[model samples]
Target chain A: MELIAERGYRRTSLAAVAERAGLTQQGLLHHFPTKELLLVAVLEARDRWDLASSAASAAGSWRTGTLAQLVDYNATRPGIVQTYTVLSADSVTEDHPARAFFESRFRAVREAMAAVLRAEFGETLPGGLTPERAAPLLVAVMDGLQLQWLLDPQDVDMPAAFRDFVALLGRGGD
Target chain B: MELIAERGYRRTSLAAVAERAGLTQQGLLHHFPTKELLLVAVLEARDRWDLASSAASAAGSWRTGTLAQLVDYNATRPGIVQTYTVLSADSVTEDHPARAFFESRFRAVREAMAAVLRAEFGETLPGGLTPERAAPLLVAVMDGLQLQWLLDPQDVDMPAAFRDFVALLGRGGD
Candidate 1:
């Protein structure tokens, strides 16, 4: 991931990745057959890490707690967000290997978010404010915030903005 | 721009751009000394087109009317939005030329939006929400909406979402 971040994915090769991992190319290939597979593994690892960290942060009362923690977590790991942004942009092309990976990842992430929202709000949300409807909005906000943050990290108050947005959701605004 | 869109920017060249534009390579070089300069021109052209369209659409009423028009205009230009997204992602590197282009574009767009918002609500907005603060939120929402639209265009009701979000701002939701 660091290599890809420093030098783009197209320039980073499997051998370089293996070298970075302190393993022979053959040994790395035994675990992951192709560079695409390795990229997927890297993405999955990041996703799992995010979920685990979010879950741990929400251990007690995520439902009632402020959403600032989640926003702060994202702020700390801009690299993961940048990777997804870069890969997702590339994946928009029909033949990009990571296209399917991002599609599935997006679906899974949205589902998990919707589930969390459903659990939190229960039946109080307004009509048509179902998890499915809200999930896209939430994800969109995150993605948009990341873009702005990348452009001008100093200008974007990620946690504050997210907290306000979440509070508006809680209030059933609009 | 078409060449870069068709063939990824990294793969495209000044000669191709000149060929596409029906100009000599020296002529193109006279205008843009480097590939990065050409890309910046393309990005600026895109920004200018979007701004012009947005201004035309938003020329009438300052409140709901203009907001709706802006959303409508954005909905009609998915390609332009995608171009911006792709370029912005690529411009994350410090040395990327599109970085400065986007930074300036973002500032200019936000200023235009802030002027619109200020014209709409003036000093009477609920909670006295300044256009500066509201502008960033509105831009964030728009940026976020584009991502969702790219992923699943059918799933997002762009006009309705923007309308509702703006309406909420008119209230004290900000």
Candidate 2:
């Protein structure tokens, strides 16, 4: 994660990842035969942090505080966050190794986000938007803020911006 | 522009770009002494389209229709859109060639967006959020949607999603 965070996926080598992991190349190959497989593992490991937060939401704790906490946690771990941000955007390219991984992950993410939103706001959110429609925009804002914050951390304030967006989402019915 | 659009900055070579433009390496080098200089030129060239739209906003014509039209136009030009999406995200890495370019561009883009939003909605928008606070979110949504759309063009309708967001932006006043 650190290697890819600094150099990006295209420049990072498998041998380097293995060295960082304290495993021989052959040993690494035994568990994951290809670089794409390694990339998926790295992504899943990173996403596990978010999935745990979502699970907390499912258990009724992932509100504004939890969301803000997640953002703050991410801010402290710039290396992991940077790896995820750079790779996800890079996945947009044709023939990128992580393209399919991100595509399916996004499909599931949008669905999960919609489900959570539906639970919170009923079938439709405030301002007459169905949870389905609002889910992608929510996802977009989070992803988008990450890009800006990563580029200009001093000005972006990822946590505060997200809180404001959530406030916006919950507005308009009053 | 087309070269970097297809291969990304690191993967693209100066020689290939020169060949594509019917210029000798010497001629290209005279114009842009380094690859990073060429990259800035390509990025600036691409940004001219957006700058023109922002200019229109300054002239009082860049509202929902123009915003949607810009997204629709970008949808038709995947190569150029892909170049911007990939490179901008890639710029977050340490010592990346386009880091300064994107950092400053985002500052300017955010400031410009804030000015336009303030003009349309006043100092504080309907939800009691300031235009300065709202501008980064708007930029994030646009950029974030582009990333998702490029990855899964069939599943994600970039322009339509942006249109939904614009409508959402206008909704709270009612």
Candidate 3:
């Protein structure tokens, strides 16, 4: 994952992954037959890790606060986040192996965010924005902030910026 | 630019660029001594295109309105935007050739955005958010929205979401 994060999907060869994991190419192939399968396993592992961490942090519930916690958590683990950022952007192109995974992941994220907004703010948020309307904005800010923060950590305060956004959403609603 | 946008920086070769542009490799190298130089020129050309288009549409100025217009304009030119998206993400790697260029570009962008916010809102925006603070968010949303829109244009209304963000910034400030 660290190798993939630093080098990106196209550059991170199976040999590198095997080397990183202290396995021969043949040894690695014992567990995963192809690079695509290995990539899928890596992604699934990331999802599992995120879910486990979220569940632990939020006492088995993931809400807006938990989401904020996740952002804070991401700030501490730049490598994992970088892996995600790089892969997600790479997946935007047609025929990329990770395209469908990202597509479904984003759909799930938007829906999860909308559910959280609905729970926290009832139906409408400040300035008459629906949960559905605000959900994409929420996801956009999170991902967008990650890009800036990654590029210039000294300039972009990921956690504080996220907090400011949460405050905005928590402000006066119609 | 279209090829780079599709295949990203690492995969794009000078030969491919030469073929795409109907020039020999030597002919291309006459203008850009190296691939790195060519990449820089491409980025600069993109900035020029954006500035020229923004100036024409916004009457020789760039405000939040112009920024929104740029987003609308970007939707119409997915190739350039995708090139930007892919390259920007790839550039996040510490050793990427475009890293310094992106860093400086972001710094200038943040400063420009700060000036714009300060001009429009006079020092502070709603919720006491300084222009310095809000500038990153503005830039983040623009870039972030591009990612989401690129992934699923049918679902993500990039312009409308941007307008909503501008509205958020405009509301209830000192």
Candidate 4:
């Protein structure tokens, strides 16, 4: 699947997608009636792969190290990362189809991350933040780093920067 | 003027701009031959507003508190924040007109942030990160937080979280 979503969804047609996939347009529509549906399917497919890994790590309890590992994994797959980076930003637009998906996803992600923080640090983390408070910021650091890395891969060492952030998190808050 | 950029750039027409601005289409086109020029004009116009403030703070030496203040300013202007949030993400696409603008902007931003860190922490920061290493991550956190805030303003307290991050920066490395 060409998940590189630099091309906004509006510009991509079902016929183009069908032609690209070597499927009849009707066949493609039978499965996904709209371009937005196809986009979400692709997003979900990507998330499934990610969720599987996160599930594996859940048994061990998600740690800063696990997040750092995920960052390392992302650095290896620019196409996947770019697809997400572009789409998430696109979702912010008014009436974007992906908005609901992202909203629910972010809520779940923050909750999952909060659970991870709680498992690791009980209630308050080392820097004196509750899990609820730190979860969004942790997610933000990852999302923000991906944007920078996608834009300038040579200058931004995403994995290294994430490691640094994890270390900073370990330090007690002033 | 309509910085609420849920409407992607391509969909926004020159006629619409001219109509909205109470200018003739010919007059508007005379000033900006292409829509990209107008987009950049809006971006630069916004930057000019922001630059005036950052310039004031530069004399006092850019500090964490100054950044926190900027976040507070962004909180008041959702339209302005949404415009930047949408455009920066959109710029990641193939052949996006805003791509060059963002690339150059990011470089300058990182350099400016590095200078700020160097001023605050000399060679290295509290967590043993060099000003150069931390600059991009700092940028990432802010950008990332903005995405989360735009998506869920009711849930995310951008300014407080930034203050917390500033506190993290003040702590020594583990």
Looking at model 4, give its docking quality level.
Answer: medium
TM-score of chain A of each: 0.77, 0.82, 0.84, 0.83
Could you give candidate 2's per-residue lDDT for residues B118-139 as a string of tens digits? Answer: 6666676646788898888899
Pitting candidate 2 against candidate 4, the one with the higher lDDT is 2
Q: Whole-model lDDT for model 1 versus the true structure?
A: 0.68
Model 2: how far is A14 from its true place, Å? 3.9
| Chain A accuracy of model 1 expressed as TM-score | 0.77
**lDDT preference between candidates 1 and 4, better one:** 4
Candidate 1 lDDT at B137 equals: 68
- Look at candidate 4 and give me any clashing residue pairs: none
Per-residue lDDT of model 1, residues B1-174, tens digit only: 667557655567888888988999999999999876776777788756655665555554345566577678768766556666667776765577678777777777677777878777674444445677666667777877766666666657877777666755565423
What are the candidates' individual DockQ scores?
A: 0.38, 0.58, 0.49, 0.58
Candidate 2 lDDT tens digits, A1-174? 788767665667889988998999999999988887787788898777576656675676455456667788887766667777877877776678788899999999888778767666677666578888888888898889999999999999998898878777777442
lDDT of 1 by residue, A1-174 (tens): 788766755567888988999999999999999787787778789767655666644564444243467668768766656666666765654466776777777777677667667777764443336666666667667777777777788877777666655655565522
Q: List the lowest-lDDT window of 10 residues for candidate 4 chain B.
A: B1-10
Which scores greater on lDDT, model 2 or model 3?
A: 3
lDDT of 3 at A135: 84
Measured with C-alpha atoms, the lDDT of residue A151 in candidate 1 is 77
Distance from true location, Cα of A170 in model 4, Å: 1.8
TM-score of 3: 0.88
